[model samples]
Target: MSGASIRAPYDNPMDRHLATTSASPTLVTGAAGFIGFHVVRKLLQRGAAVVGVDNLNAYYDPALKEARLALLRGADGFSFHQIDLSQRDATARLFAETRPETVIHLAAQAGVRYSLTHPESYVDSNLVGFGNVLEGCRHNGTQHLVYASSSSVYGANTHMPFSVHHNVDHPVSLYAATKKANELMAHCYSHLYGLATTGLRFFTVYGPWGRPDMALFKFTRAILAGEPIDVYNNGNMRRDFTYVDDVAEGVVRTAALTASANPAWGGDAPDPATSAAPYRLYNIGNTEPVDLMTMIGVLERALGREAQKRYLPIQPGDVPATWADVDALVQDTGYRPATPLEDGIAAFVAWYRDYYRA
Candidate 1:
């Protein structure tokens, strides 16, 4: 592995927070997935040995996952494993063999609409898979486990700029419910097993090589193909669309800073974001919510194609607006997501055009 720090394009103030070298490899689940792939690259660039695990399921395109994996395979200090985390025995063996000191758990069934039809996938991947990961970390002497939570957990929450301290008991979708469950499960482990766990509730993350099912990717494809793109809630939605690199930076920085007991935490007040145990939760986002139609306009400019809009009512389990309050993340990491919407969209469109040869 090269001992050089992460270079430009991916470089940020958080680079200083990364350890020069780790005694044990950092294991990142869903390494083939979009966010996991970026996080792994960032870690490997910082000279950290990374054991990347992904089942490469056909939920979307396994080809894209494989492509992401191929890039990581070429990098030094990075290794890939094909393992379905829902399988208890396989996950246990992986933990025993790798014994990673820091585990970044990013694998889970991701999608809101799909969850309505295929609720079983959410159960197997998000709930069962997450349980296996927690078990692995608890038994393997893992120092810290920084896992992905989603802004979707703010379901039915009308409060603008969602804060981690707010209660999230009313999840509108199974996917969101499962993510909330992961936080609760992590808290249980931290309270009982002395595990240091941090949960990051990421807003709508988008950039180059993002997931196919996400709005940005789908809209880009539809517009380029001259198909009418579905405009849900009649383009009335608002999202804190964070850049992928920014999210990755937050993940790595938070991983380096292990969770600790909040001395001020009390049973009387009982803060939801922190605890007496070594558990913490933060909202990692751009902090700026963009209108759906405005984002579409930006993308139109980037791709030089106008999308034919098909207006539709909001789908079940979909929130009309999402805004993330990232004050806690900034206070902890001394970094905030500052990518401009135009720049991020341009980057994604460039990658999309190049990758598709369009």
Candidate 2:
């Protein structure tokens, strides 16, 4: 690590950052995934010296992920590390080499539906791997740590918009349970080590170079191939579909601002979301839950082809709807997602077509 503050790029807002030593680099754990690639791109645009680590696993299409990595590999202040965080020594060695002051840990086994078939994967990546990250941060003297949680953690809740303050104990899937476990584990780290930690709960994130496993990407493929797309719960589902760039923006802003201890927090009647230690959790979402049918309509319009729909009941480990309550996020960070659903979907479809020549 170098010992000077690298000037942020010209496009950054005046108050977006503070002067800091350059010896501590910024590290992103899942730099090749949809949200991770976007997050890495944003950090690079701001002239932040960054390190991106990923195994480039064949979770979806390794070729697509390789394309994302290709984009980052050419940047001036960016570097890539091919490693899995579940391998304790390998993960620890990378952290030691980077000496990062701020870390964005987004590498994890994703997808609620897939968790049913691959529960062990979640245990390895989301649990043990996260433990490795916490241990690394603890020994490295990291100033602040930002990581991804998910709205899937809002399982078994009928609440209109999920709030950070809400108790998220009733997880309906192994995936949600693992995310909830992350918040809990992070809370413990904050309490024991006084580490500044923030957990961001993202809604349905979609965009170009997006995961082929997500609904939007899958539907696009199905519709383009002249096949019937699965319309779960007979098209009754709703999602707060957030754009990938918007999510990346929120995450960057959060990681730069060090979390602070809540002055009013108490133990007798504890709030699971915040702590007297320098720890906080927030929802970064579109704040607009669009119906599945409406989203399909937008995709159809973008593709210029009506979807052949096969309506079916909701799959196990899947929820009917998801909305995010980001009031606290706005009050703290002064930024919220403003992109409309139509614009995001259209952009994704355009990028998908160009990337795959569909």
- What stretches of model 1 exceed 4 Å from their correct place? 1-21
Q: Per-residue lDDT for 207 in model 1? A: 99
Residue-wise C-alpha lDDT for candidate 2, range 16-89, written one tens digit per residue? 45224455679999999888989887776676778999999987889988898887786777889999999999
Question: Evaluated with lDDT, which candidate comes out highest?
Answer: 1
TM-score of each: 0.96, 0.96
Name the lDDT value of residue 308 in candidate 2.
Answer: 93
Against the true structure, what is every candidate's RMSD?
A: 2.0, 3.0
lDDT of 1 by residue, 244-343 (tens): 9999989999998889999999999999999999999999999999999999999999988889999999999999999999999999989899999999
The regions of model 2 sitting more than 4 angstroms off are: 1-21
Enumerate residue pairs that collide in model 1.
none
lDDT of all predictions, in order shown? 0.92, 0.88
